[model samples]
Target: MNAPLDGVVVLDLTRALSGPYCTMLLADLGADVIKVESPAGDSSRRTGPFPQDDAEHLYGGYFQSVNRNKRSVVVDFRSPEGIAAVRRLAAGADVLIENFRAGVMDRMGLSYESLQRDNPRLVYGALRGFGDPRTGASPHVDRPAFDVVVQAMGGLMGITGPPHLPTKVGPGIGDLFPASLLAVGVLAALTDRERTGRGRFVDVAMYDAIVSLCERVVYQHSYNQAVPTGDGNDHPLLCPFGLYRTADGWVTIAAPRDHQWQALAKTLGRPGLGDDPRFATNNARVVVRDQVRAVIEDWTSALPTAEVVDALSAQVPCGPVNSAADIYADPHLRIRDMLVELEQPGSADPVTVAGQPIKFAGAETRAYRRAPLLGEHTAEVLGADAPPTTDR
Candidate 1:
């Protein structure tokens, strides 16, 4: 089936996570995402959770997950011809994406300003540590950054994990969040182009995106004159809305609403506790957060996660704290088509990656395609006249 972005051509100059992820979403919808890799290929190629049997090390899960549904052409940027070939590709492309530091592309002569002159409607998408100077100046523009740095500086780590510990989130949300926003920005620019007939530059900073993700911090500080810190599995304003220990494992519970709280109180065999002024309203419960936690755990700690979920699933929002294994075993993900299987080079059977979450009603979603091998599409894309290697 023809997808929404079938004819859109995207020049993917991103490496690692952010840029590739942005293009990966586009490719999943049928965009022709041409990933231009360096001589060494994307560093993530070696960053893996690789198959134990694959001694040659091929590519790892990190690269495969985000780079799926795109084409790869290894290019050696060291060669002037390679750089020019990329510029030529940019001149005719609909979109160009990169997650380099602000000035990296400009130094390579593939700056948005020059490329836009050739393809006036090209949507220039950049995901950077700070931001592109075209949009705004940053003091740390020259500094390199990664997930940990952004998570810390953006106030995410400050409010994440336990108090005073400031732990990094398990997943690279600092990268992924900016990438997702850049995809939205690129689409918005494409939409605007339909009217103006000109594409605009789209910039998303990792730091800025993470800050936006923690928007609750802004209002809490302003409204309550409070400095938010990690509350240890509990919410600051909402009471009894956090994780509790179960006999087997942990289960998350959120019963902040009055009726839900009352139901929870009744389920715990203390219906009178729901009516107590100290715990009647959500506001009151917040004032006695520890008491609420102690009360909930008193009942939950005796039950297994599954039993707790079964009891509270209907009236209260609750579920087990799932691990990767639990997620794979879940029937809900299978029913929703959230797990997809595709070929693995050395594995005996196909391996699974996440399925596209964006769905179209009544339309058959595209099947998952494995990520391209390095330079796999070089011959097919560039043909006989293709620059003799080095489009890095």
Candidate 2:
């Protein structure tokens, strides 16, 4: 069956994570995405964790994670002919995405105003470290930002981890979050274009996106003037919500509601503790969290994680904190098809990768193509049935 974005065509002038991730979302929905890169290639191509025998191929695991289901075209936009080619490609595209620094596109004569003149129905998606130029410069705008930088500058680092030492999240939360917002903007603009026959600019900033993710901190600060402090192993507002050591491994227990907390107390053979003034309510429990956790840990520390899981399943909400090995061996993941196996393009054995998170009842969800080698589709993308691949 045809997918939702079957007829959509995207001109991807993005490199690295954020832009590529946005296009990949469109491609997964069956859009035809053509990624345009410089002749020197995306810097990510040179990133490590290369394949066994194909060190020459510019295919790094980092690049592959975000670039699947797209064709690639390498063109030197610094040249007059190259600028003309990109404009030609943009003329026929449903969407045009770029993540270059401020003024770079306008300098090359390929800004939204210029491109929209040719393709008025094109959704122009642009992303940067901060809000668009229309907004005044931010303290961190001129300096480059990755996930860690946003985490630090956008208040994520202050609240995460222990009180004395702040820690950044391990993943590319900054890049991925903005990419998700950009994807939503692109789709919204596409929907609007269908009705109005007019395209618009979709801009997203990494800092803004990160701040949105950390909004709960703002809520606490605003409501209580509490100046939220770090809670290393417990929930700030809820009781009995933290990791506990089991006989074999670790497990997390979250008894957020009053009923669940009472039930957890009963399951541990200490129902009377719930009546104690110090542990009577969630707010009070937070004050005596160490005493409450000590009691729960005393129960969990003797049992295996599975036993604890089974007992908690019958009593309250609880689950084991899975490791990579545990997740790989999980039956639930297989049943839900959260992990998928695909045939590798150049290797004999199939490669298993994380599947799409968004599931639709009737729509098929799968990767359309493997990640492209650098300029893998240069000839095909710039070939006949198309205009000359140059501009300026």
Candidate 3:
């Protein structure tokens, strides 16, 4: 069966997490992605969490997670011959993606404007800390940024944890979210190119993406002139919509609506609380959130985590605070094929990585190919007689 993007070709010049993640999504959707790397290869090859028994440690798990389903070709861009080869590849590709600092591509003479001379219909996508100068430039355009930097500067950390204690999220949404948005922009640009026969420049900034993700705080600060503070696990807008303690562990319950609240109250053997004026409506409950929380915890404290979930499962939206181990053992994940096993190079055991989240009705859902070895496809792609030093 043909995939959604079977005929589209992508020249991927991204390293690290953000750029690679964007290309990975395209590759998963059946785009012919050719990962262009330097002679030293992607820096992620050295990043770890290596297997215990693997002596070679060829590629670490971090690299494997986001780089599957793509071919790698090494090119020494410092040389004229290498630069010529890259231009040739870009001429045939439908899309090109990069995550370098703002001016690095221009310095290397591989800027979108230069490449468009060869392929006018090519869609160019860039993910950066601030943004590319082709779009709108910022004073901090030259500064380097990572996931944590944007999370803090974009207002996510300010409202994440307990009061007075800012916390970074466990996952690196700072990088991944921007990459996801860039993928959308690339697709949109590709669609527009088909209509106009002209490609466009698309860029996403990590800071801008995180700020968009935290838009609630933006509206609150603008409308009420109030600075939002952390309220631990509870939500500011909805009561009974946060983590709760059970006898053995933690569970989350969201009973903000009237029917759900009434069902929860009855399930806890306190149906009268549903009608009590102090806690009857969501607004009233928010005014006395402490009392509402205490009342719920008093009943849940006497029950184990499983019992609490079982009792409220049909009545309210509730689930346990799962750890990694719990998630690995979850039957729902197995049924949905969310955990995929892949054979890593030089390792006898298979490594498990996350599966693609987006699903299509008839399309294959998993990455069929594994991440490539450094420059493994270099000679085949550049032609066998190209140059010896070109295929590091």
Candidate 4:
């Protein structure tokens, strides 16, 4: 079935996560995304914590996670012929995405200015570290950044963990966050083009995107002069909003609303505690959060996490903290089609991967194809009309 972006052509010059992820979303919606890789290939292909059976092709789980529904073209960007080929491809493309460091595209003569000169209506998207051309020079411009650096620098790590230690999230949200933001910019540009018949240049810096993610901390710092400290699974402003140990495992309970707090107190058979001077109001409960949590834990620890979750959910608000295994076994996830399986190129059987999160009623957004092998579509993308290649 033809999807929303059926005829849109994207020249993907991005590597690793951010740019590829942006293009992947477009590809999933039926855009023809042609990923242009260097001779060495995307570094993520080799850097993965891979599955045990196949190690030769660098077909790691990490690379597969974000690059489905697109074709790849391995090109030596340094080669004159290859650069010419890319220019030719860009001429007919609707979007061009890249995550090279500041000035890398300009140095290679493939900047937005150069590409737009050839294709005036092309949507140019760039993903960068702290030092984008728009942000001028940064000390870390030359420094290679991963999710960790962006999280640490963008104040995410500063407020992420407990008061004693700052921790980064397990997933590579730094790259993916910017990727999502860049996707928004690309779509917005496309929408604007619909009105004006002109595409626009867009950029998403990892630092800036992470900053947007943690604007609450910035607001507290600015307005309240509060240097936020991590609350160790508990919310600083909300009482009894944290993980509590159950007989079998852990569960999360949150009662921000006064009505919910009253409901929780009644559910725990401690209704009088809700009206107590130190825990009567949300503000009071927040001030004496530890005492309130201790009282709730006393009631919760007697039951298993699932039992506690069931009891609390029936009365107020609570949920069991599910492990990865628990998540995989979850009936709701299966029912919603959140987990899907696809066969890897050259693999014997299908392997489980994440499915598209959005479900537009009229859109055909199925993951019909698997992630492409490196240079798998070099010939197909350039068209069967072009010259054939013997190179593997």
Candidate 5:
């Protein structure tokens, strides 16, 4: 039952996805994450894939997915008393995470400088569109940003889809990636505090994180004078390292190395293709990527997805392109505990959310509790003596 962050208390003043995701990871690792929400509650509470029968429409899957294993304490941030209550929570917390605009926390008089005075060892983390002025200032610091904005601006969208048709990625990596980096930064800051006995401000910008995620584009542009553009599913550097069409569905195949390429050629009953002058080396294959793709698809298009996987998976990296339904039915993911079932707040039916990816050797890292209802823990956390506050 003992987890890595067993004794750590996190005052989570984040809404939507980014900050909540960071705190969710901490909460999964056994941190006492107290989510401080405004009276209206997190915006995600209303956004949902709601059950058809639930007329009252409690919290939706979007809210539940990232807010699990945490306690919620709703406070009216505009009220002086509510601010005092947050200060009390922050004073007793080991970490405070927020994803509001740069000056929002400072205007509320709850900046890291103000909180660290009460708890010198507190790790203050901020996830923002640009970055906090305390770390570095930018012209776009005040502009609001979303997943699409950062994905487009950070070069991910540019290299995502087919040529001349850039596409946004399916997942919200713009926000989630920054959140992940902030979590690591918070832990690193906490580690440093053990020696220096001082906490520090950690900031992760959505734009910065996306740029870091697309690190390859930077080096390639510099070294080759190549502005990376979308190349469909095929990798620019490696031939036959992309999705291929099977008879029934699509499957990804990655066999760029010589031995793997030879094995793939042999498996497809085309061993001579591996030694052919135009397809012999990886560079040659890349130079003639369309021909390589045609050759591979020519073999795969005759077989079902399962058959293709069975034929090449043992020898090369290959997998079917799984949809949500496919993932739900996948025996491998089920055995690995990647799909977890949790009870809905109001409905009798249980919903399945993603399980923790980081597996500890002996520690419990699963989602132990459902997402809390709005203001569910306000009284328990603030104590009976605390002043009454609006829970809108």
Candidate 6:
């Protein structure tokens, strides 16, 4: 099926996690994303969890996973000729994105003002730690940031992890969220440009995005003067909305609603407890959450995790704790096309990466294109004037 962004062109000057991830999404949706790298290539190409049997390490998992479905063109934009080539590309591009600290692009002579002069309908998207000064002034505008830094400073860590010791999340939510937001911004700008005949500058700050993700922190403090802190595995407001220990492993169950509680009570073979005064209403149960935990665990602690899930599963919102191996073994992934296989650059065997979650009903875009090697498309994309491939 033809993708929605079939004819769009994107000039990707960003590297590392956040920027590359945003471009990857656009490419997955069928945008012609041209990843422009420096002489040494994107720094992420060096990060590897390579296959043991591979002889020639073309690139690592970290880079391949995020850079798939795009063409790579290495250009040493530091040289005048290289920057001119990139500028020529910008003149005909639909969107240009970057994650450099503010002022770096201006210094390189490819600022929004310079590029938009050629293409008035060009969407310029900037994803940064503190954001560009052109959009808003930030004290930390010049400072660089990564996933852990934003997670800590953006109120997420304040209300995550154990009570006193705030911990970073397992995935790179800081980078991913801001990247997703930037992708949204690019799409929105493109939509607006169609009507207004002018493209706008889109900016997303990592710190701001993280803080917005934890809106509970804002409402709790504003509405009740409650500066929220991480409450461990238990949800502070919803009783029985947390992890529980099963006989063999753990399962998460959320039965906070009255009907769900009743169903759970019946499932646990304690039907009368559904209407018991102490645990009847949600507010009442919150007050005696410990007793609620004991009641559920008393039933669950005897059953294996699989048995517990089978018993409470569809009736109550419950699921077993899953690991990477569990996800690999789950048939739901294969059925849904949520796991995609790609050629491992150097290994004989292929590798698997998580597939795009966004689905366009009729447009079946399950194209699992392998990521391009550094300057792999330089000759084909840039034509005869292109520098020798060995130069990269």
C-alpha TM-scores of all predictions: 0.97, 0.92, 0.96, 0.93, 0.97, 0.97
Model 6's C-alpha root-mean-square deviation from the true structure amounts to 1.5
lDDT of 2: 0.82
Residue 231's lDDT within candidate 5 is: 88
Candidate 2, backbone clash total: 8
Candidate 3 lDDT, tens digit per residue, 169-209?
99999999999999999999999998999889999999999
lDDT of model 6, residue 33 = 95
lDDT, candidates in the order shown: 0.89, 0.82, 0.90, 0.82, 0.91, 0.91
Write candidate 5's Cα lDDT for 299-377 as tens digits.
9999999999998899999999999999988898887788878878778788888988877786544556889998899
Tens-place lDDT digits, model 2, residues 247-272: 99999999867778888888899999
lDDT of 6 at 337: 83
Off by over 4 Å in 6: 385-392
10 residues in a row with least lDDT, candidate 2:
383-392
> lDDT by residue for model 4 over 98-166, one digit each (tens)?
888888888888878888899889998988887466546666776678888999888888887889588
Clashes of each: 6, 8, 0, 0, 0, 0
Q: Tell how far residue 41 is off in model 3, in angstroms.
A: 1.2
Residue 216 of model 1, lDDT score: 92
The list of candidate 5 runs beyond 4 A from truth reads 364-367
lDDT of 3: 0.90
**Number of clashing residue pairs, candidate 3:** 0
RMSD of each: 1.5, 2.5, 1.6, 2.3, 1.3, 1.5
Off by over 4 Å in 3: 364-367, 384-392
